[model samples]
Target: MTGCKVVAIGGSAGSIPVVAELLQALPANFQFTVIIILHRLKNVSSSMDTILAGKRSGIMIAEPDDKEVIEGNRVYLAPQNYHLLIEADKTISLDYSEPVHYSRPSIDVTFESVAQAYADKAVAVLLSGANPDGADGLLAIVSQGGMAIVQDPATAEYPAMPQAAIDRNRDVVILTPETIASFLHTLND
Candidate 1:
């Protein structure tokens, strides 16, 4: 994981529990910046950052502002109704473009930007989702020589999302939530 500087996680339905589990498993000082894009309602207020910031994880979690610098060992959540993009200079930019696939904060939008920004130094994970939103983005990451990980459909609460990614990306690593957590914990070793 020497060259991998970012870990991009995208999910929809049934993703919160898995994300929490992964966060709990990851060491506080995990080297890569963790960017999360979870499909959320457009107008609803959110406390996702606080909810994910349990004592065990001890990681700083926040919703990123436009043009905010990306820092390692922190977790950034995509704000509702806005798409998140990573800049070449390791900063984040928020966009209010029309929704893709009927959703803003689209996983595909964030994943593709991260692939371009980090190239081979990025890892993208597609977790449980009801809709097939993250497939193309995960493929984009793989196409850019980045690693792709998909939740095992059998273990997913909703399999459509992970299954879509597996269908599109031949090199995706499929793992259960627990296994995925353990694998991620080794990134900085």
Candidate 2:
């Protein structure tokens, strides 16, 4: 692969630690714009962005505001109670529509949008989760000729999400948390 423009990661149960590990491995100057969609409770407040930022991984972690431009070297998280959509113009759009799979920040919604916005230049990673939300979205990425990586189910704390993706696309790349980071490094320009 030459270089990808964006890397969209989705996860739910038992994912925060894995996500932090992946982010920690990326160098401070990593060049791909990273969008992360994690299942969050609609009625509760979260300081996840702040918690991740406290890790001092050298990457800017934020919950993107509506219409914010997507930029490389930053990790954007979908805010609570909104479906994060990637616009064709490379801007973020938040939708307060009905939840998908009972989750507000639906991984499927973001992943599909990313597939449309970045097409072949996109990379989608489905991580540990208890539900099947990300499976279809991972397929969408693959359909667009983008790379789809699923966390090795054996290593995932909750295997349903990754396994669902694997079932949807047998050829999707499967990697452990450490290897996922290594593979992503190869895509950095």
Candidate 3:
């Protein structure tokens, strides 16, 4: 309760396997509320929680509700048709607003929210994604003094998102999924 506030992760398509490997690489007590931003259809309901819950334990996982407190030791997933924003008070706010970069639950929005809230204590991560959606947001995290990490383009199944972030911001940490997950384990320890 007295450390970094959040870990915001973005991914899509081939990200499932990568995320699984990252989760497996991490130790059980890896703290912070892990927020996952995925490309989801607005009209279709998704059970990402149920899908990922099959993998591991020691952390609760669910779709985030508007104004819900982001607790440590939980995974808050962005629901379909909503942009998940982290408020200044460390709670989540769901907005059914228009899409940014054609994404309903934009990764950019989530990263910006975390950047504004926790700054240097926040960690914004970009994984395998097709478009350039998370590029600006990753830059925002660095601008706000938060840690910015992206999956290595060579390792990422879809490299555009990570490549875009790197092209936009040179200082970002572009690493493999395993390395990023390991880095999280060392934070605040």
Candidate models: Cα lDDT each: 0.90, 0.90, 0.82
Per-residue CA lDDT of model 3 for 1-189, tens digit only, reads 136668888886568777766555554776677888888777776787777776766557799778898888788889988899988998899998899989988999989988998888788888888899888998889998888888999998889888889999987888988788788777547
Please state the error at residue 108 of candidate 3 in Å: 0.3
Query: Candidate 1's residue-wise lDDT over 38-147, tens digit each?
Result: 99988888888888886345688899999999998889999889999998898999999999888899999999999999999999889999998989998889899999
Name the runs in model 3 displaced over 4 angstroms. 1-3
What local lDDT does model 2 show for residue 185?
72
Which consecutive 10 residues in model 2 have the weakest lDDT in total? 51-60
Candidate 2 regions off by >4 Å?
none
lDDT of 1 at 189: 81
Check candidate 2 and list the clashing pairs. Answer: none
Taking all chains together, the TM-score of candidate 2 against the true structure is 0.96
lDDT of 2 by residue, 1-189 (tens): 567999999999999898888787775687889898999887888998998787655678999999999998889999999999999999999999999988889999999999999999999999999999988888889999899999999999999999999988976999999999888777865
Question: Which ten contiguous residues of candidate 3 have the minimum total lDDT?
Answer: 18-27
Model 3 lDDT, full chain set: 0.82
